[model samples]
Target: MSVSSAIPTAILTGFLGAGKTSLLNSLLKDPMLANACVVINEFGEVGIDHLLVEKSDENIIELANGCLCCTIRGDLINTLTDLLARRDAGSIKAFDRVVIETTGLADPAPVLHALVRDEFLLNRLRLEGVITVVDAVNGWATLDAHPEAIKQVAVADRIVLTKLDLLHGVEGEDKMFAIIGRLRKLNPTARLLATHRGEATAERLFNMGLFDAAKKTPQVQAWLNDEALSKVHRHHHDVSRHDAHIRSFSLRDERAISPEGLEVFFAMLAAHHGENLLRMKGVIKLADEPDKPLAVHAVQHVFHPPLRLASWPDGKAETRLVFIVRDIPKQVIEELFSAFTDQLQGDAMTDKTLSLSRT
Candidate 1:
């Protein structure tokens, strides 16, 4: 049921005053994103940032709810479905990709879950990556006060530092670099970039290794580095106190998972901890498809459709998953994965027994 031409979607998130709208505007100006579709979510009152985007046609839809992750599940799905229909009908110029601009205070996990867990849309889309914006001037304080901000950074594939223009001559550059260092400590897999008033180039932002559908050496190296950082930060207590409620962890094993088992695992996870599961992304070796590793990426419970790569990147034939969760312990997730794997093995054994008895 997988479609070959499904477009990639990227989620853009940040804390309050991170300049996401400004960045979106800059990205729209690029010819590469000329055919890209955008979904912008606002907190309290819907503002005029939608009007500011000049290059793209007016297809802006606002999520009036506090955050798309919490309140706009139905609306989000229906809207995306409708957009796809229109693209199919050729009503709008065919868009190459979609970008979701989350509210300043939004938690990106649920939004990702919606993309991945939906049965109808699972085969129609792919999650490119998460791009989080951090305000250079107020990021440290925001991370300290708001647990959401920490979760945003923990799950980001790319972190953009904004408002450097305002930091001129105010001892801001040092503080910004310090924040970037902290971010690297939090999630070393994420690449950091600086932008002035969201004036970053689109080439530097989109198509970030998510759509290759093949094993790439750079991506494998990045994943390995991310694994190393996660191990190092697990013992670092100073960083833990800054956002005590949020944490990031990785799960890996040499065994391949059955598709049914994987589905059951994700369904149970979404049902039990959808609110706390901020982001999850990984490469898995499925039992039926050992030669082709499946890439799974999700925010909250929403997941983009699983993609099959041409070959294993770096020849690592293991399953590795990274999670950014809020108030969810690493041990809890580890135990959950263990229990699921055990159950899957038991089920297979019982099926084998039944077949032997029938014979």
Candidate 2:
């Protein structure tokens, strides 16, 4: 649904030496994340200690191109506070978006939470998305050895697999596939991209968050990744480890859903499995407004108001909702919706499979 535009912001994170810097350098060179202010953990000054704030001028570095990069000389909150003040005052160039690159071992939740903790920031900044980088060669080992890597993958909206060119032997190739399997098990909803030598397009990376996006039909289809989600859905549960317990599934409805029923369904999800819900978005037929389908999305416990499109995209009639969740079972969602409206037809499984309970 289209809402008041907040300046889009993205968090870039990965395990140590996971090509995060290379991605940041590449983004700085591009015009895609346009008119953006970047907050980075690294900027030539070698850090000496943890919890010790480095002292430096909080001056904004104007890139050769038209963008601003703020090196964090102090804590992230202080840096953001100063940057906002500078932008307001005429000390720095105006920017419409922001990108924050976290330290290799940093947990992303706190960084995201920081943006929301302050009411002023909540009004000014929108936590757009999380992009995590993984080195293909070392990725499998990294995931296995470090709990941080799994958490990073689990929270990401986009996961970039780097250093594919370095993978040579058949063994290495197999390992790469194995890594992909692990990623899918951890977070199936995230769009995965493979880049070698850091090559990608603006549309492929930027303007992804629903708030800033124009909400074109094609991008919606790409975000859903219906075919890939279905392919990954068949056998992901077998591999869900203790820490990496996540799954994705889609629902379909032949009968139109009334607005009241829709509201009840969303409320049930929030009250029942809010914490486990990662992302949910879909365009579906509404009984009240059948010709004008509705699009809705929710992240964690926050559900945005539904948007009714002028017309259905691509003349697709089936109502669909794709969910990327952590530990919430498919049957739980299915039964809840069925309780409110007509029997829900889960697109990801057969009738028998949909009846199965969460293990």
Candidate 3:
């Protein structure tokens, strides 16, 4: 398959009982994901989501209702390979996209690795994005206790906060804001949207990568959320205790930097602190092309190649890097990146530091 023709795949993940299956059901009801295939991976030998889904077939359930729902029979790679064969043979519907719903306990890295490292799937499929469903009612407690939940929030490309109705006028009202604040701190760059009973439109959740879906222009500002960089709001003491290990912050610099310098900084970051570097993404100001900011992103040690946009998104011409790290301090990243670029002055970084100070 040609590069452009590669199927766009989105991984939908969240902690256990985070309403992933409910969101999948809601999305399947809509025409937004028409001709899309789904791979449901549950924890045990017997999958639950496939049974929960109202489908006809067990292996390759082709529903005119909307998308194709396929339960994982073997490993994910084998399952994807099998789906491709079915599509090629006209046994099932031809799908332009694939959405993989992982079990709540699964870590996304290995799953992404399966896609990235697979030879057959690499040319035939492309990772469209990762969408994480956050259960607002129990999400705070989940994050506090589960490392899996924290990782889910960190690596998410887009976060959907579900169960908002449960928080209305309840004593857990403060907990709702607390969850939002925690999500922002864990992944400030990810676009956070609210949903009720998994009612969020499929279109809004998908198609959020380096570029905006409509114009394919760089979406630096939209995903990066510069406003998040301006302040790190504090959560209640109970909330704080849950996510003491995970830290989120932004490093900013108005000065334009050379690509070579940025590459060096990137190398240093991944080499020195790959594991602690949970997720990092942002657009940077380049001296030669000030208007065309460069987009960079990484999950752990896997770094996507830098993309230079045609123009700034929404005219927010500034260099900002949003980072979600574990056991790594904000000052450590600022000093390391600045040391390589020589673009951040001590006082300038200090000023930005003040903006990110815990409230």
Candidate 4:
């Protein structure tokens, strides 16, 4: 389904004690997000975030601002499907958007995979983007110690830096700057927003998907963020060796690729190196229809059905892919892509030559 046709769903995640609840509370109260339905996922048996709202027996809470909140009972798919059913039946307030708050220790890839790959969810919901909350005071230490914390930052579209208000004096300022530098290294494409003095607001966080909410048009450049990725790649050595395990990079090709070649490339990547791939998103210029670029997305091994745009957003007909991965070398992916696409081009030329000889 095209992104514009589905509900824009945002995933809110953070490390332990990163103040995700504070951000969620603030976001839910925003007038722009008044029609949003939130699904809160907690690690343990008892979920705490939803308790802040007025409770109901069915684990669903109705906020005074016309927002709805529900805790995941067993399966996330079940929870979302139920919400859709309720809205359609007029049993619940219809929500135009969804904000899913994941547990502190959760890996967000699975949640994204479900949203993109699920047959039912794909038609009803579109992945808006990931909003990761980072605690500025302890963020550097947390990232160093926990891989989950690092992954959260790596896959974020927007990184919210919390606890800046608590920082004081020159030492605190230095520490804050250092953390921001590290965040840029981990994920340069994500927009870093400080929550100090109420800077991080709903206006800055949502509707960052394939289509811009305000314009109702494709925002390919913003969604791809290739410019930021390219800048990071230029200063690749500036990133610490300790951070070598996780890296973000972009690949571009001016040549159009056949449908078969594209299939083989993705299949091999997923089957062999899926675990290392954190997230992949790109716009492809297909050989069959070069003008109608195809937007592709994948989380780990699962991929979203490619959506064809009406036209290239920037009027530049080229293929560009951005990847956030763990322990997957850029050279490896580049070689694999080249082998399939180039070989297919050669075969096509040879067939054309054979047809000319017969004529």
* TM-scores vs. true structure, each candidate: 0.76, 0.76, 0.79, 0.89
Where model 2 places Cα greater than 4 Å from the true spot, the runs are 1-6, 41-59, 71-85, 106-128, 211-215, 236-244, 304-308, 343-359
- Residues 155-209 of candidate 3: C-alpha lDDT, one tens digit per residue: 8888999988888665678888878887887776677888864446887887666
lDDT minimum window of 10 residues, candidate 3: 350-359
- Best candidate according to lDDT: 4
TM-score of 3: 0.79
18: Cα error in model 4, Å: 0.4
Q: Higher TM-score: candidate 1 or 2?
A: 2
lDDT of all the models against the reference? 0.68, 0.70, 0.75, 0.81
Candidate 4, 165-247: lDDT as tens digits: 88899999999988988889888888889887677899889877765332433566688888897676344543454465888
Best of the candidates, TM-score: 4
Candidate 1: what lDDT? 0.68
lDDT of 2: 0.70
Clashes in predicted model 1:
14
Residue-wise C-alpha lDDT for candidate 2, range 18-79, written one tens digit per residue: 88866766666666755778787876532322222223344556665666777777777778
* Candidate 3: stretches off by over 4 Å: 1-6, 43-58, 73-75, 81-91, 117-124, 166-175, 197-199, 211-214, 235-242, 286-291, 316-318, 343-359
